[model samples]
Target: MIGAYTIGKKAVTFGYKRYGIPGAVASGGAALAGYLIVRRALKRSTNADATGVESAIDAGEVKSAVEERGLGAVTESETLERAIDEEDVGSALDMNDVQSAAESETDAMTEGSEGDSSDER
Candidate 1:
């Protein structure tokens, strides 16, 4: 009976010693996974906001450029005109339309540059 008791005590002591390491490892892994998820989500949100801002800037730029250069300079300029009409608040000075125009212009520039690069290859 005493031998059995000693063996059981030894087994419990060994288990206790091993348990701490595995417990710590599991906790660390969970924390890392949670941190990575949060980081990725934040990055995605930031990128979306940046894209929105870029679009607004493009619209403004396109409006100014057309005003300075003339309507003939803009290719497919009707898109910007339509966005302005959809807003329907002002005729000559609409901020939302300016933003949309800027975005479209930026997108065009990016695509054009990419096309050029691909053609070179």
Candidate 2:
């Protein structure tokens, strides 16, 4: 038992002083390098359309449509028109929506505080 304990103590001391910390650091660096390499490979493989712009926009379909309608064209093509319409609708949050959301949040806070007050009483 003493011999085993002495062996274990020496092993632990040597490992702590020499190999263990360096080995752990090297392993961590290798893992990080592997992760980065895999991430780069995945990104490259999936980047068929790197710009991420829609085919219609990339091909100048919107410009051609506008040109066909003349320089003073007020009407957009269906594709461009729909895209603009979507953007407008998404951005057009009215004051009523904000007021209702605020009121609901205030009501919830008041209700929670009322419950807590009753519990204290």
Candidate 3:
């Protein structure tokens, strides 16, 4: 958003220097559109996170970082973004367990198919 605002400022403030009034208007509109696009994207992100997601963090589920932060500045609903360091939604997935379960299922399927094929033959 800051970037968008800066771009809009530059476009409107100095666009006239290069391309006159028409260019200034065009650039200003483009910049405003870009800013609006970013604003909508961010709003959707927050809404999606706040509404609900599969295995996503619940409102009561306080992350360690939040605890560390002491919740002093935390909002009533921040959507508690799932960033790389946050481990918000991703931490729920323990890959090793999922892998083992998949491997077991594959082995069972292989055994069953082998028995069926031999019986048919």
Compare the candidates by lDDT and give the number of the best one: 3
Provide TM-scores for the models.
Answer: 0.26, 0.26, 0.34
User: How well does model 3 score by local distance difference test?
Assistant: 0.39
Query: How many steric overlaps does candidate 1 have?
Result: 6
Taking every candidate in turn, the Cα RMSD to the unseen true structure, in Å, is 25.6, 26.2, 19.9
Residue lDDT tens for model 3, 1-121:
1244455566666557778998677656544443333223333333335222222432222222233343221222232333111233333434333334334443454477689999998
- In angstroms, the error of model 2 at 99 is 0.3
Q: Which scores greater on TM-score, model 2 or model 3?
A: 3
Question: How does each model score on lDDT?
Answer: 0.36, 0.33, 0.39
The TM-score obtained by model 1 is: 0.26
Candidate 1 ranges with C-alpha deviation above 4 Å = 1-91
- Candidate 1, 1-121: lDDT as tens digits: 1122333333344435667755444433333322222222222323334323233222333333333343322333343343222222222344344444444554555577689999999
List the pairs of residues colliding in candidate 3: none
How accurate locally is residue 114 in candidate 3, as Cα lDDT from 0 to 100?
A: 83
| Cα RMSD, model 2 | 26.2
Model 1 deviation from native, Cα RMSD in Å: 25.6
